[model samples]
Target: MSAAGQTTVPFTVPSFAGEVSDAVVKVLDSGWVTTGPQTAAFEQDFADFLGAAHVVAVASCTTALELCLRAMDLPPGSAVLTPSLTFCGAINAILHAGHRPVLVDIDEDTLVPSPETVAAAAARTRPAAMVVQNQGGYPVDVAALTEAAGLDRTRVVEDAAHGPGAARDGAPVGSSSYAACFSFYATKNMPIGEGGAVATSDPDFADRVRAMRLHGMSKDSWKRYLPGGSWRYDVKSIGLKANMTDIQASIGRAQLAALPGWQRTRGELVARYDAALADLPGLVLPQRDLAGVQHAWHLYQVRVPDRDALIAELEAAGVATSVHFIPASHMTSYRAVLGEEECGRVPVTDRVAEELLSLPLYPGLSPDGQDRVVTALTGALRARS
Candidate 1:
């Protein structure tokens, strides 16, 4: 339990100190800050890090997701199966790209859409694609989900917003299957202030994403500066402005350097939290499947009976908390498409939405700070009984 009335502790903010500043300094010194050399290098380096065939850096994860959907060129009204337990960006992307997002349920323990639910949804909708999220950094069983959807017709797009160094069965998150999106958002495992990337094994898909990320211009800004580079360029396709800048890429490059050490520290913290909160009644600990994958530990989310009450209690004790989602179908915009009664049919998502709460867990979090969170949560849940 949190020690009596201790409300203040060391404030831990996500940082970009180490090599981040130095890298950014280089970008500043270079003068040309827009999508240029650093951005190209970052894309190549990120691809290498994930062992992916190609990687495209973009302004944000939303852009990455949107661009992927747009590049795929799905038919109007085509259903794209996605988890209800994800950020709205993926859902919005599906909608913006001329498809309907068929929201699905997530497994209670994993917080990711289960193979069973995905199979059921696919069977019903025969979706154009399945946008599976590595919910809260816990790698979804890609093989299982892929198998569930069956080979032909439906493609899988991994929304790995919380995954950068994440893995499944010893393979990096973006390397395993279809197009995988990674966020280098301010709060992600690797901070790029606000940016993202999409990696894939498919060469054609990668090319399409690359083209779309920069107004569908066949040649990028870098290529235009080459020795024999032509001045005139054609608009290959009507595309959006979603390219990543050299400045952001410089930050991403630096963060990539520090990623391994930070991931190791995250593992240690998860272990400590797991041990500290182990036998608390009514508190469902976040589950981990260490069989093949290495968790990125983006946000340590758990289920509790009175989650809102628990969050209040923890906040009063000086702990910050967040909820991963509030089912997209339940939101006003989506609700118009999927009414209350229809949305409630996704039983697992509907029920778990009330129970899910994310605890404070990040690289900067100190052992003492973590202890405080554990004590606060355990005591809060215990008090209810």
Candidate 2:
């Protein structure tokens, strides 16, 4: 909410500093503006940031996930266990990679499949691999989850789309997952308008992702188009076109420099939200303050009784709210592919989807605006009571 005229608070805002625009302008001015040096720099910088052995920049997190899955070389239609409460992209990526998705149930509190849930699901499905998401920017303990599921570490793929800056088990995300995907969507912690990446320690996996992202080419255009470079390139295998552009990478590079401060701001804001909403009746605050973990605070979600009614009330009070997700199994498109039998009874995911409500969370959201949101939310809840 704004202090003047009290504008409605939006659920998310894409915060940007001046450097992003400056970087974009620089890229535009440079002769090369596609997937060239800027993209390469961003990939290297991201790898350094996460302490990963390799990183491949891509067009979107979904694309990165697909490419990673494709590199798995699993038997066609292999079962890939994934959370039902996660973004549809993870499930879609599995299907796109010629695999079957087995939707795993989530922990009601964490809004992610717990080790126990994953273990149970894995036992039932005997999955070939799993997509573990860092739900709401809170990193998952993939090592523990993998152990609980009795799966090899190499078979786990991380859907870290919500969190690029989050840390778990004494290491940053993308540091250890066999492969981890990240997003730089407009509303994400690292806003790049629309971009994503794949980070991994496996050199072969990185090479495969790089080749597949641009038509399985032996040489990327950047290498082929530079002065004294040959136009000829070899297509070694079937692949998709999902390369990140230099303009996006330029902005991403600038954003990377600004990320730490932005994350700190998010943490501070989340702290206020935790303290303020603690007293609100019938409200379930999101997972917070895990030991040895740094939450990215991507979405400050709260589960409220009468979620629909509260949203309407909040709307009337000039406050905006949105849900993190509707279970992928609940959506029609996935239903057509998964069918009822395949995606059966993600009981916790189904129940929690109704109550999960994402509140206003962004670097630009002022304390007063947050206060206004809180006041409106409190009023709305009180009215319903």
Candidate 3:
């Protein structure tokens, strides 16, 4: 049973069956499955795609965020400004790096922190660094945000978990920041199951992340286990086990090659959604193609009335949906950190958290599937009204 009377439309389905499968099998047969040649190749390919100076593949985006913050070498308990309306990983990374997380509110339309808000928070907190997220794969104005934070580009990190092929002002997302972290989770825009990368133009920062992704060893295991490798190595600093496996990199290489086509398909799907749902009452569509930037169209989120009831209605109709976030300020752990007064500061975040709904949007999502989602949503909204 489905919204259109058959086959449920899923929230997300990774588009990897042919070439991706072949690539993974090839890696399995190669016998070197750790952070070896495949991982190196994937990193190089991704860097070339972004025109970035360096890129380091890691175990997950969470690890990449932590790695970037640790590379900053900030003092313990230093303030780090981040958005309240974002995935938990962003705030968690700030706390994990021995920094205090200062939650900022987001813009109502874009669901991203505005430059003015960031500037105001930076002035109040005098934060050592700022973590700006490209919420739902929409590229944020990093240059403006950096200027607002009153810090150089080096102190800004782009949490690009929803951005892989996204660009801003004729440049890739990672090209103009201190570091941009990408996710290749099962449901993210780029799917390699569980992997991520940190892209940066700074050679020194890239070097630090490369070393820190492993065990802070002077030489990586790939170098130590090679034919002419030496067993002798030196430890520099404490690090984490966040290196990406060659198997994951193998799949990522295939996905990276196909990213352009996949992005095109997503854009087409988004266009269809926009055209069909534009006039629906009590529903606000997500922002699209602001100024000169390209939106990655990773999530087709909409703000609707009776959000929970609409989700249930769609679920009964066989269309799976989800919420992008719960607003970090509302979470118990973040509430404890942000206290009561600060928690009530994010009015927009609080409202949007209750209204936002992510519909089905992915490369594999068929037009018929999208139509079903739209129909179900329309019916739900009308019924609620």
Candidate 4:
């Protein structure tokens, strides 16, 4: 129902405005707003939701990745295998953890690193760990990837930043991995303005993450302030300041509660998009969900010829769009580490990067807005042809 002059449709918008506002105000009134009871409650609730044994809330997914890597205690300069076609945070975490990142190419169809690719990379680099990412909320085959990488679950970390509600082979993403990291950024599946968590089944690993998240203190501030609590504590080891505040946790809890319904809405929107755009020319849709797996539908990306032109056309028609990622190898910082020749190894990643386009798909997007997007996109493709 929209026309070229109609109001613009945003790429994404956080849901439950009223609930988030109320949660924030309640936390403001509680006085104890730092990483306190609310954060603990959120951590427990999130762990329960993911069917994980333990969850440690942090300030961001990047920090959660760093925490997970640090917990592993890998040797400095050890190689960590990761996909080049993913968010920069994944690679940044590897570099920041004092490890050398071994970039791998993605499968053309699934847009994720394949088991074969991982195995090949592992064979070449003898990577100490494999950071598997669930790009765009599509759950990767973790078991197969781990087997191919010749690494046990203990050496594999799931970058589930886009995969909070996703499942693989009838198990939730966090449940199947040794450790899974999630994000609650403003635009993530669960919007908390800024927060993340590390979920793990190992109690010892969980304890280490908990300690490392808060200055490596013997006890966190919440525990130290309790009745009969000791006034003194020991700094067990050097740690990062990545604790999640109660305010963010409160918002995260509210968002978590509303997530199921929002996810349903997202699924419905994706179905609509598939139906509307299936036959469009010079376009490649995202892969369909495999049997027994649930996609979180965080991003509705497609491969199209003249991707930039389509984006410009959509913008002129008042529809907002985005790009999910630019390959890590394409970045200047990574280019210095991975020489141009090495970066060119990911042919699929480079090709996909040039053609990928993220359309507007969110809980609040209306059917009419989607129709307008489809119309604009089809028009642009036809015009080019």
Candidate 5:
């Protein structure tokens, strides 16, 4: 018995009040809001927080990815191996940088590409780079991928969009990767409304990324504004305008300040959801495998039978839901590029597309809200049964 015209429980939302508001007020009072001291502090603090050697903040993850690709200066039409089950931005970044995206399938449960798949794709294409995604905050087997690709020929560009506090094995996400991109989009665990960063251990690569992120300028505006700073700067190359502003960084700084506590709450909430939904029929919980790895828990997506109808039922009962993605090849534009034969080859990603569903999971998601979600899901599953 699915009800009609039901209320909506938003899938994800930023719950910021105290520190975020305070930071914003201070930024307003200071009157130097566009990429100033706060932005620099946030960038430095974020790099320190993640234990990465360099961090360059950008307007969005797409920008961050694009800048990194451009910084690499791969030959035109160079292929970059990436999971097919990812946001279009990943693919777009490839095209924007005058390269081709070599889409690959993902593991069934993890929803991330396997190193074996990466190797097979690389062998087929001799890729210049591999963009691995930490799908749903589940860390990919980076070590395995590195071993397969070797150090010289393959460069890894990690789309750590869902991995802020996430880890692989014992290493924190973005600690020392070839190049890692993180998103602070409004829906992410650490929302800055619209901002992202690229992290890397290679100082030279980081410097290139910095140059490309802000009009290819020789120096950032902060350099010009600091004491004994010069006003003149040179434009080294043609770059996009994709710098993070202090206004957004103010919120990011606050969010970064509270990330650990937020992660703990998310973990607890996921455990609660797991315990409640464990035995429910027609539902498959997301999997976790790394023994010592930490998950940021950015999303708590699950798979279910007849996902569309279940989503309707959940909405009818005041629980919101979302799909992680519709496979990239399914889109009309990419369909032409990959062709039907190639698209059908990604069996794992194709299967998950029919059933993936994201539940409401955020720091301020109340216990009562979670209980309502579980109850609604239980009822929906029973009704479907």
Candidate 6:
């Protein structure tokens, strides 16, 4: 509620307290503010959290995906499989990495590509690499998908931007994938305002990414400036200016520490949404429970018959909503770059694009605010009915 007597609900909110501010302040005060102790500590802490072997922080998830793809050293113009019902950035990264995007269809239930879809795409293109994303924090079984893919284990990169600490069958996300890329963006599970990281199993691959993230240089600013350290470093290979700064990593460390509690809160809120909307006619809720799978709960999306009308009604009532993504096929660049035939068959992705609506969900969203969202939702549904 505000002074104008309007009740409001934001689509998402970042949870940042004094610890985040203090962490940034401490980083700014330190003479070494660029990739240094704080950034290194955050990478180690994240690796420990996911039980991953080697972790390297980067500027964003897009570049993380690009770097991981480039690390595979796929032959030029080789196809890279990814979900069509995903953020266009994933497809763009594949293109930017000098690979062709062979968009695959997603399962309607999970909103993530199924093993069947992976198998089908694999047979179609015999891709050199694939990006298996945990869309909306719903885990995609990498092992099953890889087996179905019939590709080498190292060819797959898990887009874990939504599910960094999320687990499946007792193993956390980064544990199983060849390479899992994580995001610490403003609205992500572990909010760092802006940054990302890649966790891989192979030490050699990790070393490649570490050097590649900083212009393929042998030594970073931290290593070069250490006492008796040489400023004379060698350039190893081609890389990107995609290094995560200490300031962002400092905030990310705080968010990572509070991750478990925040995740529980997200699950609780989703439960409330599930219970409240269960009886509402013509409303299709997201798949919430799967045995041995713990969701990241980054999104609480529902499929309504008239998405646009409901969005309007909610907006008028001071409630906000969002669409997870527009299908890649619908995007201008994807169509121009891949053509219709190259994008491949995607009936489910095309259909779901029109119906999906994401509601307000975040650790900072209060119970009363949730209730307000529900009330506004019910009223809108009733009117549409």
Tens digits of per-residue lDDT, candidate 2, 1-385, equal 5344558888888888778888989989998899999999999999999999999999999999998888878889998889898887888899999999888888887788888888888887779988899999988889888887787888889999998779986799998767999999998999998989999999988999999999899899889987899988898877889999999999999999889999899888988988888888888999866788888788888899899888877777778888879889889999998888756769888888899889998899999889988998877776666
Per-residue lDDT tens digits for candidate 5, residues 1-385, read 2265555567877867468988999999998888778887898999999899888888999988888888887888888888899999988888888888887887787788887777766777778887888888888767687667553522778899999879876788988886899999988888888999998988898888887888998888888878999999999877999999999999999989888888899999999999999999878998864587677788898999999988877888878889989889888988787678766767878888899999999988888888889988998888767
Where is model 4 poorest over a 10-residue stretch in terms of lDDT? Answer: 1-10
Residue 320 accuracy (lDDT) in model 4: 92
Per-residue CA lDDT of candidate 4, range 1-385, in tens?
1365689989888776458888889989988999999999999999989999999999999999988998899999989999998889889999998998898888988889998888778887788998989989999998889998898789999999999889987788897468899999888888887889999999999999999999888899889898988779999877899999999998888888989888899999999999988888899999876787788889998999988877887898888999979999899999999788778878889999999999998888998988988988988888876
lDDT of 6 by residue, 1-385 (tens): 4334686788888887558888888888887789999999999999999988889999999999999998888999988889888887788889988999888888888898888888888887778888998988887889888788788889999999898657899899997567999988898988888899999888889999999999999999899998999999998788999999998889888888898888889989999998899988779999857998888888887899888988888888878889988989888878988887865488888888899999999999999989989998998787767
Candidate 3: residue 352 lDDT (0-100): 85
Q: Give the clashing pairs for model 2.
A: none
Model 5, residue 334: C-alpha shift (Å): 1.5
Please provide, for model 1 over 81-124, each residue's C-alpha lDDT reduced to its tens digit, 9 standing for 90 to 100: 88877788888988888888877777787888888888877787
Give the local distance difference test score of model 1. Answer: 0.82
The whole-model lDDT of each prediction reads: 0.82, 0.88, 0.89, 0.89, 0.85, 0.87
Better of 4 and 5 by lDDT: 4
**What's the lDDT for residue 282 in model 1?**
86
Better model by TM-score: candidate 2 vs candidate 5: 2
Q: Is candidate 1 or candidate 2 better by TM-score?
A: 2
TM-score for model 1? 0.94
Please identify which of the two predictions, 2 or 4, would achieve the higher TM-score against the true structure.
4
For candidate 2, the lDDT comes to 0.88
* Angstrom error at residue 82, model 2: 0.4
lDDT of 5: 0.85
Q: Which residue runs of candidate 3 sit more than 4 Å off their true CA positions?
A: 1-6
